[model samples]
Target: MNPGLHPSKVTAQFEPLIAAFPDWHWEIRNLTIEGDYLALHLRVTGTHRGTFQGVEPTGCRVTTSQFTLYHLVDGKFADVWDLVDTNSVIEQIEQGKAVL
Candidate 1:
């Protein structure tokens, strides 16, 4: 639930992430809504233009896929869970695996 990846939960925590990836974009490829549960398939694209998780900027472009599930309560978001393919993104930035 921490948007900025901080251990502590805080609102607007994604500000640092926005600074780190100024051009970051999360595109939803698929979505399914059933009752109070919503599922999202996404592709996240960005450039490592600033520091993240203490890792210095690499200026590398990264693309990663993720699946997220959100629980709704009274038409508002209550809880969220995500499954991201972080290894693929790391390989792109560090090992030059994918060519996108």
Candidate 2:
């Protein structure tokens, strides 16, 4: 796990992500938490106001879905994984399907 992610794991990912984003955030839609497993379905929306993927700023609005899962251990988070609709986002960017 990246220590930089989340401050003490107390929903603290927002801090680092905000620092990196400085533009937008992950808009959550559906979240499920049971036992040591955490599941989340959300959308990552933002403008390329900052450097991302070695690409310069485009100032375009981007929105993409993300599915994430986290594993908890000893009460604190232990492991996590996530999947995003990369092709959809890429097509949107390349084909101007969403213009963002």
Candidate 3:
């Protein structure tokens, strides 16, 4: 999560992406749990149907990776760290290729 942004504002950031990739889907590639921590590796797939990141829709399919870690306290999330490969997604979209 970005330090400057509130957690509640995080979901709003995805609204543009949701509109751009209406059919986007996430697939869990790996999941692990250790003590109070949970980690996940995910693959995301979608088609560029609307503008995103200042790029106009090209109707190209795109795939990207995301990794996330969560710290649990009393069975609830206390902290979260997340990463997404936005560069790869942009490159694929610009090249008009589907990396899937």
Candidate 4:
């Protein structure tokens, strides 16, 4: 998890991504719950339709993986950590694969 990031700011951080990939979809590949912790493995798919991270739209369909964990406290999320395969997404965009 990024030290400078707080969970409350997550939505703001993702707003640009949502705009860039308006049709982005998330699929849960795996999920686990144990005690006060929950974990997820996810597959994300989308087409680059708008500017993102200073990269111009390439119209490339991209697939990436994400892993996330959350700590629950008294039935509410108290902390969250996540990792995304951003390098893969960038490589796919740079490859300029035609959208299917």
Candidate 5:
């Protein structure tokens, strides 16, 4: 789904996840910039405390990694691409791993 340039649409995509992971935190692991392009590596952690996509809270401490690339034009973001390790999140919830 393309969230496009609309702020509400962009917020909609994460509203549920945010509600589900109220204590979520994103830690930037690495960042690199060259000209108009930028890349980032991050570690995200949170506790499952609310429903996400109909999946009930597992009360598990979830940790996942993500990578993102951005292209800027005139100092404004022109494009963005990302990769998130969602499998790790699913696995932790499915495996019944409790708080860390």
Candidate 6:
């Protein structure tokens, strides 16, 4: 939903976030670079503001860390993947477990 992301990749990347949590916001806690990929060691904290992937918001605060790997090809991202603890976040938000 911004100018920084590649036009082609934007929709794919944004959809998951929008669907999972409509008001999701992110912060970069750390980063690492390897060859053609940049690994974003991120810290994300926000409210479960909307429905995401069939999960309804619990109106709770949750924080989690994730490493997102983006591989660039020909000046555009060829692939985007991440290792995130979504279950932990869900546990914290819905089950009252502490996360972050």
Identify the leading candidate in terms of lDDT: 3
Give the per-residue lDDT of model 1 (tens digit) for 1-100.
Answer: 4223323443375688678879989999999999989999999998978877666778888888889998877766777788978677666767533455
Question: CA lDDT of each candidate?
Answer: 0.77, 0.66, 0.86, 0.83, 0.80, 0.73
Better structure of 5 and 6 per lDDT: 5
Q: What is the lDDT of residue 44 in candidate 4?
A: 93
lDDT string, candidate 4, 12-85, tens digits:
87888888888889999999999989999999999999987778899999999999998887677777899988
Tens digits of per-residue lDDT, candidate 2, 1-100, equal 5433354665575554344347767888999999979899998876545545444555556688899998887676667887877666555444434543
Each model's RMSD to truth, in Å?
A: 4.7, 4.6, 3.4, 3.9, 3.3, 4.6
Query: What residue runs in model 6 are displaced by over 4 Å at the alpha carbon?
Result: 1-9, 96-98
Which residue runs of candidate 3 sit more than 4 Å off their true CA positions? 1-10
Ranked by lDDT, the better of candidates 4 and 5 is 4
Give the lDDT of residue 3 in candidate 5. 25
Model with the higher TM-score, candidate 1 or 6: 1
In candidate 6, list every pair of residues with a backbone clash.
Answer: none
Evaluated at residue 19, the lDDT of candidate 3 is 94
Instruction: Write model 3 residue lDDT over 8-91, tens digit each, in one string.
Output: 666886788889998988899999999989999999999999998888999999999999998877776777799989898889
Reference-based TM-score of each model: 0.76, 0.66, 0.83, 0.85, 0.83, 0.73
Q: Stretches of candidate 4 above 4 Å error? A: 1-8, 98-100
Output the TM-score of candidate 3. Answer: 0.83
Model 4 C-alpha RMSD vs. true structure (Å) is 3.9
Per-residue CA lDDT of candidate 5, range 37-75, in tens? 899999999998887656688898898898989887766
Please report how far candidate 4 places residue 53 from its true position, in Å: 1.4
lDDT minimum window of 10 residues, candidate 6: 1-10
Model 6, 1-100: lDDT tens digits are 2224566577786786666666667899888887878888888777776765566877777788888988877666777788878888878867754565
